[model samples]
Target: MKNTPLNLCTTRLHGGEYGLYVALRERADNVMNAETEPIYGHKPARYLLQEIAAGNKEYSELLLSKETVIGRRETGEILHELALLQTHLWKAGRVLRVRFLEGPEHVHRQIETIAKTWETHANITFDFIAQGQAEVRISFTRSGSWSLVGTDALTERDQNKATMNFDLSDETTSPDAFPATILHEFGHCLGCVHEHQSPAAAIQWNKPLIYSRLFQAYGWDRQKVDTNFFEQAEKALITNSGYDPLSIMHYSFPPEFTVPPTPTPHNTQLSAQDIAFISRCYPFPASSTASTLLKG
Candidate 1:
């Protein structure tokens, strides 16, 4: 291989063939071996995603663009050789200022009560205020729920613009729906990536079904789904405990979206592993030699 832009995966898997991203996504989740599987010639889950993302021009451009991977970084354009996963973490024991641009007082209070749960587990605090520049500026007017990963929120040049968005229309705010969605997005604020994107996860995604399902639900195309659910994290970037299917950060796909051995129900609370992972990442000081975990 010529080490072209397409061969960006550090491991250098197969040629970046065009349009195999779907099939590659399906096979990659099931196979795990030192040698590529002889069974139907399927490649390991990790190897396939890196190339498949690069294999198709559309997928490659969507994923590789600076805007896609941790946009608004202070310095360089290059994220990772392959930007499969991204996280920008804060130093332990830092206070993250949060400002809710607009929302009912009750709703804002509800968010604070739930989001503050992370503080019990990790060495961080959320300082919600009405004025002054905040690291995480939230708004409920947007159509979907999302947040910039950790410090990336700081890069938003416009102070009036929100770095985090939520859809809190009356129709969407069920008792269960609000908390689950907020917790997941706040996890991103704390520098966590989607749990499904973990390299160790190996979720056997029903690609066609997932595409159709998400398209109907959120109007996302295949590129968006692939970017969120297909590529596995590079082992080097993450400090993961073996894949935790129950993490609040993981998506709860319905049975139709995956093959057998279905995923856990929609997670509204952090799993034991989620608490442990955050604790590990931001361990309490032990005689002044406290350490930190680096993950995305």
Candidate 2:
């Protein structure tokens, strides 16, 4: 029951289509299975936005066919630029409060210890509170680990509910995987996307082979495979950080996934580039007064 790393997409509506946006959001939320482990949940709204921004003719036609009017003024260029800027990083100098919704004391202690490793380098702070509303609520489940990306947690309807989950209940989650899993999910919470999806990575994926493997392994259909693996991210949507195959944000791919059999090893720790990139994204100000609280 080892949880796969899943990225949650956040949507922003423009052109006063708040009603339409809400309808879309409700549809997306309702379809997400709370117990199912999604390799990358097939998020139509997110997929539509990404595709429309990339100017994919097929998706554009699909949007039009569905009678979904992306406002005339909301050009693909504007959406692409805005999506790139907003989704790349969180606001600096923010104290993100984290609360444990459900977990044994030992597991909670371990998570608290490992999660703070990011705070040592980044400007952000993870304040673990006991009895108040928190920005990040964590819980444990048998399904694979996942988290909403960055500011998307703030948009959740249940403000006090858990926004991140760890698969501690899974007996298959080894001790070696614990730190990596926690760090990886927290990476998502910090606005980092899968390193494999980095526009600069330029991975040569063997589509038919990948589709066959994912379908057999995860019950994913053609659409899910295309959305999760085959889709190339918009180059403009990426941060300036150069690609690093060693990033903890990357999932190890087997040789078969690539045309020339490029096998990426499973990364269990943050690369040097990871620290530098996160630091740049959330730089600590010299005049900052907030204290870093490390819980053992």
Candidate 3:
């Protein structure tokens, strides 16, 4: 496989947050395997619904993009890829099991606390299991923080390995560690994408400046910059909650990276919109009667 850049730096708060980034570049000689699944084929129909619930219209369009038809031999059985706008929520009220493959026990509790903030508003529940295959396996390494989006966690071949990773090793002990970063990665686990990538967010990016800074800061090449910062999610795939500049899922860009020199703020907590959006996506069953009535 060709070398693909790692998707690091979900929250680039400062130089300290990038400690792992520097180490990873030196260790891998500035190249790492993409280690992600292919994007072709039908993802779960619920993902489409999840996008819609987040108020993205492009998701519905993406669902209508194309279909694959499979014809059978003797029995004339046929398989077809249909575009269905279904809820991508975990089995309605299922407890998503999580486990830590690495990281100190203290940090594990911290991670759990940060993750469960989503449960306060959303109907989803996370159960941290002591053993066995967990729905979300979290590990720590020099690789910058990232998590597989939503149901893609189930597609991993190495069941014992982690589907998510954070830069929470011993060397990365900064006071500002698990605030927004944990919320951002867990947002990805719940099927959220970078808020900046939303088509509605018309950020006037200073492309040359962004490219130059990232290359110098993280050893990122042109392709990596494009994929991580410039490439917009397919309108059909995005569940836009309207261009929220304060969303926990947004990255703080330096003033130099923007056209008019506007410095994007580092969001330390979930914005009110973030809470409202997740609530809509995974509302408490009892309080979701209005949503059900609307659907009906």
Residues 62-146 of candidate 1 have per-residue lDDT tens digits of: 3344543233431113222222222355668878889998988999999999899899999989999999988778888745676
User: On residues 261-284, what C-alpha lDDT tens digit does candidate 3 reach at each position?
Assistant: 876776778898888887776666
Give per-candidate clash totals: 1, 1, 6
Model 2, range 176-281, lDDT digits (tens) per residue? 7778878888887887767778778888889887677766655667875665565655553345778888888777666767888766776888899899988887
Best by lDDT: 2
Q: Could you list the CA RMSD of all candidates, in the order they appear?
A: 14.7, 11.8, 13.4
TM-score each candidate. 0.67, 0.67, 0.67
How many clashes show up in model 1?
1
Model 1 clashing residue pairs (backbone):
28-45
Looking at model 1, residue 165 earns an lDDT score of 74
The 0-to-1 C-alpha lDDT of every candidate, in the order given, reads 0.61, 0.63, 0.60
Output the lDDT of residue 63, model 2.
34
- For residue 120, model 3's alpha carbon misses the true position, in angstroms, by 0.6
